[model samples]
Target: MTIRPIVRYPDPRLALPAQPVTVFDDALRDLARDLLETMHAAPGIGITASHIGVSLRVVVLDLDPIDGARTYVNPEIIWASPEMIVHQEGSVSMPGVSDEVRRHARVRISYHDVDGNSHPEESEGLRAVCHQHEIDQLNGLFWIQRLSRLKRERLIKRFEKISRG
Candidate 1:
């Protein structure tokens, strides 16, 4: 599996909504493997296809904090509990900064497996949070969007300055 370049902030593709995976073929499977490799190389907990310039609703996450990875193809959040939890999150896409964001504590999601079989899973804690975050990326949204408007603006500016350097 090859590591794809991650699209950075300010890229228009980052805001463009991703399309659903239509054909669950070997190509799609390879993409999933590449995503897993990319995430592991980044040492990140999650990654979305949009990050690699693929406009597909696919995400890979490894919240194991031990030894496992989960790949989601066309993942959709089926349910989210009202209970919210805050966590400090960081991203390899944007280094040297972490942000505290409130996320649903529990969520149920349905997606296709590598074999193209559909399955549903319920998650909580970091798994739930990372899944939600990766799902947002599939929808062309970032964790920064959960922050206050002022904070979001500040972050964008900071990233812009950093990119200029």
Candidate 2:
């Protein structure tokens, strides 16, 4: 298992949008596997390729082992419920900081598997939150951007402190 290095917050790459994946081959499979290992090493439940400085539209989520690991390529939220729910969210890039993020209670997502098969998925609860969060990261919208200005500033300060000592 290869655990790739994670790109930390404030890295310009984290703010850049990733390109869509066009090839479905051994490389793509390797990338997916490396992403899973990197996420496990980071100890995060969800992670995107951008988190590891790879500008590809890929995400891995392992909320529970029973569900196994899931990889989404070029994932997009095709539909979202009007109802909203708040959940604590953070990123592998910006570890040690988290805040309540309000998102759709349910979401319908369209994406491709690592093998290049297209599929639509419906998710709720924490799964829904993760789908939105990782998709946003793929779109270059970091999780903290969803926070209030005051909260974001405070959180950044806290992260800075953590990084320093």
Candidate 3:
């Protein structure tokens, strides 16, 4: 597994939607492994193929390191709880910036495993937040969009300042 360079904020590729995985082969597995390595190196709990400039519907998440990482191919949020919760969120792509964003407290997602096997999982708490965050990236919805216009602008300005330092 290799630690791929993360595509930073303002990169046009991050804004583009990912293509669904059509072949679940060794290459797909390798990409998932690389994503996991990259996310761990970034010290982030979740990451997407888009983060590495690959336009593929893949996500890797490991909220609990002891439990190992989970890979999702062609992931889609199938249901969400009516109850919402606000969690501070950031991204590997947009390093050094974070803001609290409201999201479903619980979510049910349909995704495929590395071998193209179908899987459905329900997640809550940090896991739910991470899944929603990553799925947004897969759909080309950067986490900043979840923030209000004012908040997003401020965060980006702060990020720019940090980038220059």
lDDT of 3 by residue, 76-119 (tens): 99999999999999999888989999999999999999999999
Q: In every candidate, how many clashes are there?
A: 0, 0, 0
Ranking 2 against 3 by TM-score, winner: 2
lDDT of 2 by residue, 57-84 (tens): 9999999779899999999999999999
Considering TM-score, which of the candidate structures 1 and 2 is the better prediction for this target? 2
Report the poorest 10 consecutive residues by lDDT, candidate 1: 90-99
Off by over 4 Å in 3: none
Pairs of residues at least 3 apart in sequence or in different chains that clash in candidate 3: none
- Comparing 1 and 2 on lDDT, the stronger one: 2
All candidates: CA RMSD in angstroms? 1.6, 0.6, 0.7
* Pairs that clash in candidate 2: none
TM-scores for the candidates: 0.91, 0.99, 0.98
lDDT of 1 by residue, 1-165 (tens): 998888776677877789988898999999999999987887787888888888998888887657688889889999999999999876656755677889999999999987789999999989889888888877878778889999888877777777678
